[model samples]
Target: MASEQMPPVVTLHEEYGCGAREIGERVAASLGVEYVGRAMKSETIDEIAGDADEGGFVERFLRSFTPIPSHDANIAWALEAHADHEVADQNNRYLADLAQDGAVIHGRAGAHVLADRPATLHVKLIAPLSTRITRAATEAGITPERARHRQAREDRVRTDFCRRLYRWDPRENDRFDLVVNTASFTPEQAADLIVTTYRLHFPV
Candidate 1:
């Protein structure tokens, strides 16, 4: 286990199609820390270690975050408060543990999970909806219409996930230490900005 004394951590929350994964990877590379994506994946942790509730929570949480095609366009996931809290507690501990050695965590409400931790930088990446739709379409090689649909579904899901677990809105700028408008910045530029911001906030 890494020591309880943590190094600086960067937690990134982004709107759909905002290039968070790409920028987060770059930031982690620059910082020389682990880039944690889908850390909620079953392969990373035991899927059946606890009671029926724990096992069920893991399955539902995974399904809630699965890629777009598997989800219904019209239906939003209805997560239970009890299960959501269990998952939130688990996520908090796991993220804290990962940050002990420094990490850049993408999505999974990381900003909210580690909001109170010292030496943590919480960033939100977003762009205009129109810009995001275009970027998402171009990146996925999908039609604009399909991209818009997926974007709406994903954005809603992430927002609702935070509301359910943390009672906070992820889109609020006040919740983040820095909010980057990706419409004005490329992934490389955005990564550079975040790294610079982190250094400024916690100078070596």
Candidate 2:
């Protein structure tokens, strides 16, 4: 008999305040696998375009493609459509390379990047806006009003980025193998659920 095949990549797409980072970290730790998410995505951008400031290349890239006003109120940043496409291409390449390690990738269009791969498992996490706002407020040490405002801004930016780059909404349930509402479950529970699901598909 042949040895069992290793599991495919696990990709997580989530709203800004949905606790994906926490849950993904837990899942990666439990599985003894690597966790690749925003930080990795940022590093990829810096590698491709060179560093500049705090936000740097990735920040500009996201802002350029954002359909609405960006976080920076004073400086309006915009890139040509082709430039946006190039950045997105670089992101896809980076994600593909990372997924080869059979890791849990937490966002930046990872699901779409690995969509064609046979072993890839894509998940999406969502929550009620109020719940997300409270979580964001608690995490950031900010008031609920402030957190709510920030959440709305982030939602617009992320939604617009996906729409402009991938021609699809990340919130669409059809794109994911599993959709969990973080409002109903703690991060630990969410992580356990994901791990259980993965084991069901790819047993050790």
Candidate 3:
């Protein structure tokens, strides 16, 4: 018999506090695939950029862009750009390796990184800013104001990261094959939609 082909990779991008980790886990479990999330990607990137000096390519490139604690707008922009590029490259490689086995990857620009891959389904999850703030506040046992501040900061970072690295605005629905509004759909519902969509595109 011929070898079984791998399933299509499901890549999910979500706004801060959108429950991506929970939904991603559900999708991975429902599909019996690996769940690759930002935590894992961060660990991988730290390892990749390890104690190597500024002489190492990755280290040198990363160090060259460190933002100075000054009010220089141009310097800050360059710093953010460089940091975004470093992250994008590391994440792209990590996702590329995971793509071989087929996995549900959330965040770390998995969708953008695997955009050209035929066997990848890109999904985006979002919710109203207020809804996200409330959910985050409840989850973290914090004040709504604090949650709102945190969410805003995270959203800004992610927006800049994607714009700098991919020249794409992740909030735009056109970037994803499927966009789920978490306020309207439960995590389970979102996961089911993603699984169903992936299967529709690449049936057994």
* Segments in model 1 whose C-alpha atoms lie over 4 Å from true places: 1-6, 38-79
Q: Which residue segments of model 3 deviate by more than 4 Å?
A: 1-4, 39-86
Put down candidate 2 lDDT per residue, 1-204, tens digits, no spaces: 211365457899888678888899998888777988764332244354443533234455554444434456443334345556776898888887776666889877777777877666788989998889888788778889868766655666566667777887887877798998999999999999988887786676
Q: Score candidate 2 by lDDT.
A: 0.73
Per-residue lDDT of 7-65 in model 3, one digit per residue for the tens? 66898888877888889999999888899876333234335445543224233334445
**Pairs in clash, predicted candidate 1:** none
Put down candidate 1 lDDT per residue, 1-204, tens digits, no spaces: 222245768999888788887899999999889999854322222343233333244345544544224345344333343455667788888887897889999877788778878778999888999998998888878889978866755666557667767788887877699999999998999999999999888777
Q: Cα lDDT of model 1 overall?
A: 0.75
In candidate 1, how many Å is residue 138 off? Answer: 2.4
Sort all candidates by TM-score, best to worst: 2, 1, 3
Each candidate: what lDDT? 0.75, 0.73, 0.73
How far residue 165's Cα lies from its native spot in candidate 2, in Å, is 1.2
lDDT of 2 at 55: 27
| Backbone clashes, each candidate | 0, 0, 0
State the weakest 10-residue window (summed lDDT) of model 2: 39-48
